[model samples]
Target: MSVAFIDSHMVEKFVENSQAFDKCIEERFNMLDMNQDGVLSRDELQNDANDSSFVELALQSKEEVDSLYDVLFEKFDTEKKGGLNRNEFGLLMKEVMLAKAHGFGETPVCVIFQEDSLLRRVV
Candidate 1:
């Protein structure tokens, strides 16, 4: 294949992957929203806290949800809006994925992003 054609194909693939990633994030966030309000409240996050596996991946345990809420607010709620919308959730998840890929397996959601900003930024 010609170099220009390969470049075009690569761009198309990148766009497709990005869209898929966004859709996945949206689906996950919507599931967590619980109120269909397009943002995550403390109560909504409590749902995940109640789920043992989810809490394990997110913070620590259901008992630590209060602190988990604070960490999420500080890290993901970049606008200081008191709740996280889909975009923020998606961005935060992107950082989470990077953290996982970088040998930080099951550390905790808060710790994953707070220690680094480079992984969260898209460029």
Candidate 2:
């Protein structure tokens, strides 16, 4: 079908796809937000996920991921509030997906799942 032939409903289908993605993202954000304070700190981020050392996540060196948290915290915390909000968390998730999709690097199990499917399913 031509783009002109499509209607609002067709476009809405794409919007609807994001519902699941938003849910998943929110769930993850909640998981990361241990205090229910609606944001992530360096210590909070480091402790979540598996029992593995900080190095196990995203397959990066402890120095890399550790440093990344500092960078990520600075970057994602656009408000400079010292933590990541849900939107910021989603951005981080997208970054992980894109990096893995392009074979740029490895990721943690939570992020390593069928990323393409998750990305498309999200939006």
Candidate number of the best lDDT: 2
Residue 75 Cα positional deviation in candidate 2, in Å, after optimal superposition: 1.7
lDDT of 2 at 110: 28
Clashing pairs in 2: none
Residue 104 lDDT in candidate 1: 32
Clashing pairs in 1: none
**What TM-score, over all chains together, does every model reach?**
0.60, 0.60
Candidate 2 Cα errors over 4 Å, as ranges: 1-16, 49-62, 104-123
- Model 1 RMSD in angstroms: 11.3
Indicate the worst ten consecutive residues by lDDT in candidate 1.
1-10
Each prediction's whole-model lDDT (CA): 0.58, 0.59
**Candidate 1 residue lDDT tens string, 32-119:** 8888988887677677656533436465555566776788789999889888888888777776555444453323222222222222
Clashes (backbone N, CA, C under 3 Å), per candidate, total 0, 0
Off by over 4 Å in 1: 1-16, 55-64, 104-123
